[model samples]
Target: MKKVLLLGANGQLGSDIKKVFKEDIELICLTRKNFDIAQDEISKLNKYSNIDYIVNTTSYHKTDECEDFPDKSFKVNSSFVYQLAKYSNENDITLFHISTDYVFDGMANEPYKEEDTPNPLNIYGLSKYSGEIAIQNYTKKFFIFRVSSLFGESGASGKGGNFVETMINLAKKDVPLSIISNQYMSPTHTLDIAKAIHYFIKNEIQDFGIFHCCNTGNCSWYEFTAKIFELTEINYPISKTTYEEYKTKALRPKYSVLCNSKINKYYKMPHWEIALKEYTNIKHRKI
Candidate 1:
């Protein structure tokens, strides 16, 4: 049985990954308390020398926080990733790192391809891009998945829960909510990503490089919010607004829809609407 070490196991994606891999592989999950991948030296990981793979889901991805502390952002996203890559190379462990779609400038009319040039618009994007470069430079046995707009049942504690939860809570207040319509992206389910990871591992993937992994289809935040309301039958006052009207500390790509043609070679991705429907169903059962 191949042993896999997963970082940030308590996170939205990491939580789901655990569920997906529990019965299939020898999985070891590490939260920040277990080991701080960012602050801890690479030598600390030597104890797990038997690990066959290291899936890094840890990231400093808060847009505002990244803007506030560029050093921390790079430390967690770039420097730490570089260390992992270097260690993976020396240890003969396969590395799987999660990245973001923010690396693009979001000016493209169509979805971004694997070969697309990254033009980060904010500190968060720049830091993630730096990690991507570091991984490419330091390791050959690595899989970099650039995904966008993740929502999961676990709800990222650092981000104050997932976007769907935030929207539901806001709707409960019965106040007028102005959501951005200018920025578009392919919102994905964390569970789907987990399944994709399982598929890759089961298939013993040969192609190793950056792959755009997101649910098919795209929509603006406004459309996404509207769909959420439609699914839940929640009567909430939602107004569509532009990015200019939505004041934010960090700049986001106006369009960050990533093409899944590359990953499709291994697994087919469901459309965003389908995943959203599934999420709502699971959410309702919990309530």
Candidate 2:
């Protein structure tokens, strides 16, 4: 079995990648404890010289928090990625990195395609975009996937849990929610992204560049919250608020939905609704 070294192994996306990947592919899972990006992490990977592929799900992805700690954000999101890209290049391993849809300014009415010019609106997006550029420049064999609003069973790494969990908690406690109606995005599941990556590798899809892997359709935060309540059978009061009223430290895109035009023919991406419903169903069953 070919060995794939997975960074951020304990994060929501990383954990699901562990479970969703084919049994035939050997995964060398390494969490923050084992591979801290803040430290000189490239030196740590010298031992895994035989690794065929390196999948990076690591990020300092607290959007608002990133605005406060731009240095930390760039260190983890940009500098460390450059190091990983360099390491991947030296080792001749295919690198797969997770990115954000925040790279866009959210001005487009339709879904952003892979070819869209990235105009990051915040430090987090700028840093992630820097990482994307680094990977493209440093490594010949790499897949940079731009994912948006990701939530999973394992919970997010940087942000507390995820929007779903936060919404669930507030709804259960009878707390009124004020969701943003202007900012739109595709709320994707980590497992779906994992499955797509695994499929591409297993089938040897050499079409490597930046791929936009996200759930189908886009919705404002209010609509997303409504769906969460519907799936979990939670009736809660949620009011729609625009970006102007609901202020955050970081500037978010008004529309940041990613189109899977490239990967759709090879691996079908389920709609956000179906993915969300499936996630809720699985979590409920687990609970």
Candidate 3:
């Protein structure tokens, strides 16, 4: 069996990857606390040099929090990525790095593609884009996947859980939700990302470069929330708001819907609406 080292095992995406790769591959899963990349814990790979792939799912992704700690943001998102890229290059290991769609300035009329030039509007986006550049410069065998608005079974520990669950919890209070309508995105599911990774590793892709691995289609935050309630049969009031009205420290991409044509060449990407409905169904079964 081919061996793979997965970092950030406890995060939403990493956790789902653990589920997807079980019994199919030789996987070594490590959480951030046990395997801190910022401290250079990656040097321990010398003991496991036989590892074939390294998938990094760790990031300092609290959008507003990134503005408060620019140093930490760059350290986790860019500097550590550069270190990993250098290591992957030297050791001849395939590196799969998870990236964000925030790299765009949210000004495009069309969905962002792999070839488009990045113009980040916030510190978070800048740091992530910097990481992408570092990986391209430092390693030849690397895959950078740009995903947007991720929600999954495992709640993001630092961000008070994933957005969908957070919104559901807020709706329990029977209060009106002021959601941003101007800002749109392809609200992707972490499960789809895990399956995409599985496809990439199984097919042994040779074209190692940036790929947009988000769900198809797009919707505003308000519409996404409405769909969540509609699927779950929950009655909640949702008010339309704009980026300006919903003030935040970090400037988010007003339109972050990613085009999946590049990755669709390798694996089929399901629509966001279908994925969202499936997620709600799974959540309901558990409850």
Kindly list the per-residue Cα lDDT of model 1 for residues 38-138, writing each as its tens digit.
67887888999788899999999898889999999999999999989999998888899999999999899999999999999999999999999999999
What would the TM-score be for candidate 3 when compared with the true structure?
0.97
Error of 3 at 117 (Å): 0.3
Q: TM-score of every model? A: 0.97, 0.97, 0.97
Q: What local lDDT score does residue 242 receive in model 2, on the 0 to 100 scale?
A: 91
Q: What tens-digit string does per-residue lDDT give for candidate 2 at 1-287?
A: 67899999899999899998748799999987877888765888999978989999999998898999999999999999999999999999999999999999989988899999999999999999999999999999999999999989989876778999999998888887889988889899999999998998888788889889998888888999999988888877889889888778888888898888787877888999999988998887531
Runs of candidate 1 exceeding 4 Å displacement: none
Over the full model, what C-alpha lDDT does candidate 3 score relative to the true structure? 0.90
Q: Kindly report which residue stretches of model 2 are placed more than 4 angstroms away from their true locations once superposed.
A: none
- Candidate achieving higher lDDT, 1 or 3: 1
> Model 3: residues >4 Å from true position, as ranges?
none
